[model samples]
Target: MSVRQLLYLAPIAAVLLASSSVVNGQDGVAEELVVLTDLAGLGRDENSVTYFKASNAGAYERFGESIALSADGTTLAVGAIFEDSSATGVGGDQADFSAPNAGAVYIFTRTGSNWSQQAYIKASNTGASDRFGLSVALSHDGDTLAVGALGEDSAATGINGDQHDNSIDNAGAAYIFTRENRTWSQQAYIKASNTGRIEEGDQFGYDVVLNGNGDTLAVSAISEDSAATGVGGEQDDDSAAEIGAVYVYSRDGADWSQQAYLKPRSFSTEMLIGGILFGFAIGMDESGNTLAISGFNEETNRGSIYVFERAGSDWFEQARLVASNPEIGDGLGSAIAVSADGNTIAAGAFDEDSALVGIVPSDQGIDDQRTDDAIGAAYVFVRRGDTWSQQAFIKPTNTQVNQHFGWTLALSLDGDTLAVGAHFENGGSTGINGDQRDTSAQDAGAAYVYSRSGTTWTPRAYVKASNTFARAEFGSSLALNDDGTVLAVGAPREADGAAGINGNQAADSAAESGAVYIY
Candidate 1:
């Protein structure tokens, strides 16, 4: 298949959100949130800017498919999974098109409101179809990065192994890089340690995350199958059939090693279908002491998330979370985000149907009416000692069917602010708090921001693209800075072919070329 066709086969993931509005605690007041379309020559207090493919046009690069932000909001990482550059490493010729779909990551640094491209990174052993930037994560200090290449076919099993050995198709691998004095070097190459044999569809690095100190790392091999129940248990058994697994690795000095292997308490029977039960989302605290993994197709597509807590060097499952009113096809864990402390979690059920507004009653029975099908809902949970309980159920104020709200989600470090992306929302409203009554822009997408004061959560702002157009998918992915002061929204299907900062967003110029907006 062609690179563009293969790109469509990859699963869609969720994102984090940042905001320009602030909510005052008294009388539910919200301050005006500034929205900027172009980031050219903007100051620190400016609203936002849009970025697109800088070096090439009409390549179907998908520039904003995945994004990550440094804790301080001074650095940003954007991934273009379909980028066809053959660049080998940092600062290489970005115009090289010798390789197709090898992928690339762009690093931007901010100094007093000015943002400049710092690095262009790719896999050390770049090859056609590697898709190196399929997913990207950065350390809190912005010195370390983990890049996932889900289409990589290497069969090597450990760190820094031979990536040239492409014997297993789509077995997948992740590369680690560390920065010293602003220069980056390949630190490690990681893959599943206990897959037993090279499996064609294992996708070991579909999602990667690093702790604040950059010492502990987590990678989800959503396609990993073994009868393994917990840490170090029967990984050779293929009978489990795509049961899915998460691997934890710890860093001591400059060396990395696998610490534990985690799997769901009950193997998902949907494994027979192959792709649905993959570990779709993952979240961890800054200390790496707590971890949450979401399986979007678990339990007959009701979806579930497993929470684990670290005890010394070993990790143990602490709780299993599901929607209070579980219904088939709700997609409960399609998107998830955790607070910096890991005590609070927000999971999205994009297909959840409930006409009722904010904070649904906890014990309400499931309704089969499907009146609000695909309007979507997000659930919030807070940890108290060893127990986690549902704290809230969130929905948009103007709920519309098929909006697919909560297709992506992000939470502030302190868990006080939340952002939910409804990529299919039809409202033509532009910027923050515009009219939702206008249905002229179909699938134009919108994002919602919520703030929590104590235990009460209130809707704060509604966000949309400045050039709202049908099928833009504006809220497809999101990334938020630690304090939620900065947000990046991706509209991979955006037609404007403008490159770099604030170029002309001409109509139908760059179909599916993609664009990213920072706020």
Candidate 2:
């Protein structure tokens, strides 16, 4: 067992061992929940294989080829990508031989000790290179699946009965597959009004997310026109490559149509500032109306997150987010996690000021110094009626400069609970109490949990994987299940800790694997 697995399983084991019920003769351990150590294998795949052990100590069953967990956790949907052998006239000469990847999706259900596949749905005319199943999202009930085929020939005509022909370029398309009477059907196929380009890494339709009722779907085009074109034309920011965007779609009953296109008003300016540009859709909310788009490499390498809201039936730009008091050179807001309600948001400023704490005062009196870039922090936001305001700024209780890269943030609904990952902290530095962050051998990964009580929030628990080390892996990604009871922290390149002992090994000398923490 690895340290990652032990951290998660130990709690459940302790709880079970205290009870006197014999559990399947497997150490009489009545498993409340079994936390899997590894979520993905080595390879650049974004989707994870879904698994579940229905009963305590039951066999682990692979639930689907590709699974997306719904926000409610009651249902899960599986998706697959299928290639269409014949797709001619749709996209000829312009379609490069090396440029198409297609895909499809499957749905599943969990009841008692049985996990079964529920539905199989595919995009029409899916073919090799379409990469359809590349991105998939499930509604809260698992009845709807949104799949993206960014490689589809956008120039084809009469889609969803519209006479408009698809545009050339990397015109991407998204399909909404709905389940009714236990039968699944393709409800609609959506394409951008202007999809003409052959950018290899355009990565169109890279991410897809759905609202609770499946009434809303947000699709991202990292390579889409950045100018926010109401009138069609390629608009360049002059500062960045491939301006990113999120499109919102709404469904009434069973009919769906494009409703809004969202991009930051001065997003072009934000990208062009430092001559280095970065943009992509890393995460989104349930409604798809609310999106969390990330951009770094901008001025000072400090990143920013943009939140878009759907007003009634139309999606529009809601607010722009950066470090509340952005540090001049601190690269904050690089990684983000937004709750389904959009009311709560967490942005990671992995490079914010940490060393100035001793020099600066408390939250009661704001710090005035403009140049403090040692430690990192995460910003939390709460939405008021029409706009959003900063609610709290968070840092590890014991944080140090260059060590606590408070790099990832995860917020639970109601914004009451938060989980932070500081991949670089060495125990014994500041409030961090492990030898992991030591110069010669930073030993392990640590995560902090905070809870909001009344108006003030307090750090409730600090967790560390026993055998972790410096550079074992950057604890860069984090996810919190709806209730915040289950926290999945990704240490993508972690090493296998002591055998049976499940703790730390010698620093810098271990194999790489990823660990997921369940609290």
Candidate 3:
């Protein structure tokens, strides 16, 4: 049996939804949670995946806001969006908290079963409130990395533009870094071609996705207001308010350039108040030939996803997808996952107000009623050739108001294993296979794992916090290893000030200090 040794500083409790026929001969049809530690690796246990403390973790650091694991699962990246350090490049003075909300990313590598922090990264400009590490992505080999700063204020547009200029307000930018011989350096600094200026608040790099090979990337500008549709459309058009747009780029010989600008054909007049998007629905396939971009129709209050395909040097829209049974305010595509081959997609509607429980038939549609408020739902879609169809409607076995079950999603390589996070879930369940019906804790959060055999889906595991405390919301962000054998969950609101294993779980000194767990 494999052992799972972890250094968990965050206190948390909660259980999320998952369904399926019993597999692996375990209770709840889920694999048992195993923990083991090596004598040599103590502070950061050998059996533990790396334990990240940001070298100088403090309250409101917001570490674990974003996380990514290399395809091989040897490397991990964690983002602390509220990190306050003026350090530039990597491994600089982390003790300097001169820049508030400047943000930072930590890189950790595993040798055998032991893990260690290797680098502390920050934006080149390192301006205050830039939020450089709010979003992050890693290449399959873990050599290429992308960091997003939605709060960056540079007016420059396109690749390698001027970095010193900060006339623009919250235009945002994305930085690419490559590793060679265990050394890292910035490759390029990217901004939207239609970069927003002062008062625009485009937030260009709100989300970033890198293809496995690290040659292609997709960046989302959450508040872009262009009414233009299709690739290479007019960039100056601001007729639409908060009309979102995505920028695609490719790398050749260390140089990067914009490939295409993407927007769904079913456009939105404006992004609504609940339109705050996470890294959920925006992604690229293994080769970056296929992509999924999501947006909400303000008029209909319904979210939709745009799937695109690349041909030679151009990109073409493949399909626009929505929930099988669409309902106003379902919040479909709030978070989404695409298979490595881009043939399978799981879209989460966190605000979906469904009263249903467990898995529903795929051929038929959902009940489409506002039976529960913010109960949440997720849909699975399969592609046969160029056509796509919904395969299953999933819900948690135990549902509660404002559980927000589909807040985040991760799909394993080859698309068989799937994990979902309900960070708002209130269940007070602890550890693996525990009772999920207990709802005493508020915002304790939970993670659920499911496996697929042929076309049938079944529950694989139920994961909860080891400390089982409220407000930790353990699964706020998730990353799965290539084959899905390893899972990493992040919680950005842990109050424990202590670091490392067996920390002071009762310490409430640090509020909003984050932590990550490997299972």
Clashing residue pairs in all predictions, respectively, total 2, 44, 9
lDDT string for model 1 (1-519, tens) is 221232232222222233343332211123354433222233222234444444454547777667777888777777777788787878888888888888888777778866677788988888888878777788988999988887788778878777788888778788888888888888888988863355545777777778888899988877676766756677767665556778889989889999988876655445444434446778888889999888777766678888988989988889989888878778787678899999999988878876554445555435522744788888899999989998887876556778878777877789988888888888887666667667789888877777788997767667777677798787877777787666677776777777676677655777776776666
Question: What's the true lDDT of residue 121 in model 1?
Answer: 90
Q: Which residue pairs come into collision in candidate 3? A: 4-34, 4-35, 12-468, 12-469, 13-469, 19-459, 20-458, 20-459, 30-460
lDDT of 1 at 206: 75
Error of 1 at 480 (Å): 1.3
Could you give the candidate ranking by TM-score, starting with the highest?
Answer: 1, 3, 2
Decoy 3 TM-score against native = 0.88
List ranges where model 1 is wrong by over 4 Å: 1-57, 195-199, 268-278, 357-359, 363-365, 368-372
TM for candidate 2 is 0.61
CA RMSD per model (angstroms): 4.5, 11.8, 6.4
Choose 2 or 3, whichever is better by lDDT: 3
Query: 199 in model 1: Cα distance from truth in Å?
Result: 5.9
lDDT of 2 by residue, 59-127 (tens): 111111123555544344433232222322222221222323344444545454234545545556555
Native-vs-model 3 lDDT? 0.72
The candidate scoring highest on TM-score is: 1
